[model samples]
Target: MALLAPPKDWYHPAAGAERLWIGIALVWCFVMSLMMPYWHFRGKQNANGTTYTVTPKDYLERTEKFVAANKVGDLNGIPIVQPAPGTDIYLLGRMWNWYPVLKLQKGETYRLHISSMDLQHGFSLQPVNMNFQVVPGYDHVLTLTPTSSGEFTIVCNEFCGIGHSTMIGKMLVE
Candidate 1:
């Protein structure tokens, strides 16, 4: 078909509306490119890139000790811990569960450390919509200060395993 053949003036320069649209598209692309670094420097909610290498065994031990020291009760089989404000707290993701539901005080900041035991997972806090990746060999720390007092749910956004749909956790802010 004629549509499949080369244009009559294939070597001609683009002009008029075609040139104007091309220039506009280039400007739009440059603006978008600038916005990425602008937001990276200005955004408050971005990840602070604070991660440390940690073995799964060592991380599990630390979590166990933390639970033992601050555990207030047990839900199902998971320990429910109310850690003191301004202290460090641990949340471990493994298999199909998030160990030790955490309770925190509103407006008090805590260094929240998250990691995995077996496979990779996700830490997604609902309503507030903060998300972080949970890797097995690295600890991800988030300086968190819950502004409101309520119960929040944490669901694994990463497809972890067969029971990943059941990998739900809870956080209580008081």
Candidate 2:
């Protein structure tokens, strides 16, 4: 029997390169699709929803109740209680020194419910982690969490007045 050679076109470098590029593009698309829902839900705004407000006293009382009922000491004083994991929380409060002073576990998640208490103020976290504006009569809710253990500082991002630089808070994650 005579030996036979493969077709020259079978080893064409250009065709091989084209196939590699197509495979990469498909993989990129697949990854983006898998991430779509997370981005969509995170960016979605709660329009036409009621805004809830609570006094510091009311917040403390609610925290106590949550802790007592759940037998969990994880409850802290925000206008809203601890959110279900991966859920957002809407909170309202005036700008003041150390407003939130929030505490959370290492892997816990949180959505900040923030607003001006008396005047327009700024909300900033350091080591430059999160930044937002706190304006009176307007509500701002920021979805965030402390992924690492340590104390992160929250400073005023806006220049409300002389106290702008002095306004600071702490987010402690254990």
Candidate 3:
């Protein structure tokens, strides 16, 4: 049979409980909307600040220079930049890899500068519970202070290419 009927008043009335639930839901939405700014200014939760523009070429050059100056070791043909505490750390993610694994000291805050060279990537620092989006034109500065010393894996949560599953990096905190 045809899935049609003669047009009638299509308005569906709300039950008493449904009306009460709708009012409660609207109040919750308003509360959540207000909580965002409250947390942003007082939560001390994330390192996300005003975004900035970054050119891939310039970022690559900067990363190379930083790696060259701060090289302390290498892993899988990638130079490891172990900058001293209080120094800014730069890391690049492109194609399917996070370049120049970082080494930081425990209990010291680091201004970790992260950006993408090709496409958007996700920077997930495991065992420390920090993750952020790495965009091509924006530098995401993550203020990190390692509580314990260990080797943390940098796993990309965003899909980029066929090699996304194999895109893994490491960071040593000591």
TM for every model, in the order presented, reads 0.85, 0.50, 0.78
Predicted candidate 1 versus true structure: per-residue lDDT over 59-158, tens digit per residue:
9999999999999998778899999999999999998989889999999999999999999999999879989999999999888889888988899999
Candidate 3, 78: how far from true, in Å?
A: 1.9
Write the residue-wise lDDT of candidate 3 on 1-174 in tens digits. Answer: 258874587567777999999999999999999998889889857566446688989888988999999998889988888898888889999988899989888889888888999988988889776778888988777777888898999999888889887889999987
The TM-score ranking, best first, is: 1, 3, 2
Predicted model with the maximum TM-score: 1
Model 2 agreement with the true structure over 10-39: per-residue lDDT tens digits? 555446878899889999999999776766
Off by over 4 Å in 1: 1-9
lDDT of 1: 0.92
Q: What TM-score, to 2 decimals, does candidate 1 have?
A: 0.85
Q: After superposition, how far is residue 21 of candidate 2 from its true place, in Å?
A: 26
- In the predicted model 1, the residue pairs found to clash are none
